[model samples]
Target: MAHSSTASDKDPLYLEAHDDDDERRNLCGTFWKRLGFVGVAVVIGVVSVLGLSIGLGLGLGLRHRDHVKFTTPAIVTVPLQSSPPSNFVLNGLKGQPPQTRVYAFNVSNALGAPDGVVRPMLVVNGMFPGPTIEANQGDRIIINVTNNMDVPTSIHWHGLFQNQTNFYDGTSGITECGIPPGQFLVYKFGRFLTFTFGEFSGTTWWHAPHESYRCAHTFTDYSTQYADGITGALIVHPSEPSPPDFPTWDQDLVVQMNDWYHTFSSQLSAAYLSPFGIDGTAGDEPVPESGTLNGLGQYGQGGNYFNFTLEPNKTYRLRLINSGSFASIRFSIDNHPLTVIEAEGTLVKPYTVSGVTIAVAQRYSVLIHTNQTVQQDGTFWMRANIQTDMFTYVVWGQNTDVRGILRYSTAPNLAAVPVAADDPGPGMSWVGDMDTSLLVPAVVDSPPERTRMYLVVVALENTADGRFLAFMNRTSWEPLSGTTSLLLVREAGLERHNATSFAPVGGSLQDGDQFYVTEDSIQVVDLLINNLDDGDHPFHLHGFRPWV
Candidate 1:
């Protein structure tokens, strides 16, 4: 959101903060304020060290909550002839297991700007919005992640069910300490997705789950890491199909989108989690700098932009992933309506929509037809608009209208941003019916009655020390020293306990607080959440994808 700019109104700080190439370090601490629960889901696609993200359950009928960090590199180091991922159609690998695959990534630091400017960033394999990693259902994957940077780091396979391999979940404190700087870890991909679709299919993502003994809860610590550049796409394919109604398309395209911050995420987090917060806005969240589609976007930046080329009258399968850590995004193409076919790896009956409102950590696969008459030399605006209403403390981006170019016959290299062309005329909007879609075949069944019901109150509260904090119930979470929660719980087998508690020692890095809950036995459970604040919030139950 660009504010009214006049030569007379310009200030050095404003000009410097706006320029990604300026040699300014953490200048945002002087500019402004906001915050969220999501890995700070990182740092809305930046990378985090130490923590591994895990999926607790993959059952017959539900999808679990994911808070893993997603990342993208700042520099555009993609070699020649690499196209955006395919969409709409089932992936090439079948879902049947009995296979193993491995990929090694060197995580390091770099300088570049996804929004066409330069800034400090974390990179995986020299590309931001990291490369797409695909595997068939039931197959094993070995992700060999090497820390090539000075800081410790890790990767959590966001939506995968780590069935028996809880240690492999990549949760730093809860699973294992992060890979030390100059160290490497081989994550043996566990068998996660076991529920086969009789006639269903969908998409999911992997992000940084910043694990920290410190700042395990808020923006001050690991939350800001992955918000910049470390997110990637993981596509699971089914081996066979029982239904004959799945739609087929010529090209499959993966469109990864999320909200972005211009200043360093740590700086944004400091402003967000500041004492009493910025300007006395105790519960306000930090507003993001802009939004991105596939790791590239330009907000009011002239010349080169992120664009997609298509052939007229051709159907392209598009997989949409919300890779941001905080802000929710709504997407729409100038003249095209999308036919959504899948949600969160679960196949549903195809539905149409003019645009979609996507929350953080959500994914959808839609089919778009390039049937529009070539206008503006076959160029149209593809908007990835941030939902400002979903947040409270938006210091900037009040007019977050991030755009890219789309053309049927134009070269992919030539594109621009926010160019105003006349509307494509009044168009129809589509509302998603998750309930109806869930009833489709291959539904996983859950036990009828819940053995235990956990009540969580989502709240924004002041700590005893007067720090403004976001939490569930009343307790702030702090990780245990030297070991993870899983190992602790496993070791406490003979000890009588309903829940566990530990206190932090004096003089540690000031981070947010987090606590934990443990179950006595394996019984079907119910989670009841009540919001104590008025603003928008996304609640996720780490470990299991439960039926909602």
Candidate 2:
């Protein structure tokens, strides 16, 4: 009985106590709390790392945006020196009025903004577009070209025929190497004959001759160094300063369209990106701006704005010139009719149109009657939007960038329109096949004062870099030659020649004049054309349209 009690009677109280102790034990509570604290610390460290990464990313993004905003376009001033002589007197012919006087000056290249920056330029009468020269039909013109810059230069009469007076053609090699720097040359020619059909008053332009190549080559980095900013207009009025018989407006606006290439850095990186190539081809470079009116750049807010005053009912003559190296412009006055009267200095039968397309070297003189109310603000815009197959090689295709304003005055007593008797209808189109017989008839018996021949030679040679090198009359203009001794040697040699024999010189022209025959009795002026595997050069003549 004692042995059995030893196994079963092993204290029920002790077993109960053991069970109670097991039930009261807090086994993993402390461990769980410690683990939770560790987890919280790890989470805080990860969150801090993420916040710093986000902050750094935001700061970098803002800095990049600010840098882009700071690179804004700026206004560049180009120094344009004046043409040398202050005054010139052109001689007269037999039975003609006395020689007319013309002022000569230069427009130098100013290197900064339009408001300041002064550079040497060759201008007539100290104006960019030379002063309008008005004369009777038979009056003679005397132009004394004075070179005041550090380079040699010449003046071309644009459309006037040299006939026997080839020396005054204004072409450096053709007439004579333009007067050297600090030198002077005089050009005298007469218009003793009357036109049979062409109108007396029209639009035209004038520019520096081949000698301008000196500047052209020197400033090749700047697209418009020699041609764009350096050029001007030449308005040859039919008669003296008598008010027009037609209704006239209070102001006459002459808008000269031009292209410019400015330097963003001293290294000419901006010019290097120019879209318009030096020889009129497409390049990978950038073109900050294209066309402008009155020397205003095409970018920036209100940088190139032109404002004009107009009465309620008066006619205004808008003379437009397509002075760019390439691109024809489509000009129009929004909500107004344009009555075109002339083209390229030749009057045409009037015609009306909503807009007109003007080709390179072409001029248009339109008479617009602003009869609308003052509330109707009008815009006279010139856009180069016409699609042409000719611009296959041009970059960005065809686009115009010139515009101006034609605002009607709010003034109470508006200007009165002249009688309709003098207001000619829309003029004829100058784009048709020109009827030679209809042009100014050849002076039947009047002996030619001078006769000269111009041979236009174009060459496009392959360059070492696989690009084509273009040249006028076989002379590849070397941009680097500006600071070289070759330029001075050429200038000194050109100065030694007789000024009279200056007609027809330069590269192949010089060689031709030396090797080709010059007969005295030829009547008609001949312009021989030869394309030397080069690109096509659109040859232009001012004042008078050349017959093909």
Leading candidate by lDDT: 1
283-383: candidate 2 lDDT, tens digit per residue: 21222234455443234432333334455577767777765434444666545667666666655556566566665556777677767542333323333
Which regions of candidate 1 deviate over 4 angstroms?
Answer: 1-91, 94-98, 191-201, 215-220, 278-280, 374-376, 391-399, 410-447, 497-515
TM-score of 1: 0.73
Whole-model lDDT, model 2 = 0.38
lDDT of 1 by residue, 91-209 (tens): 55653554766566666676655564456666676556675777665556667677676655667766665444545666655555566666676665333422221211356666655
For residue 186, what is the lDDT in candidate 1?
66
State how far residue 484 of model 2 sits from its true place (Å). 20
Angstrom error of the Cα, residue 273, model 1: value is 2.1
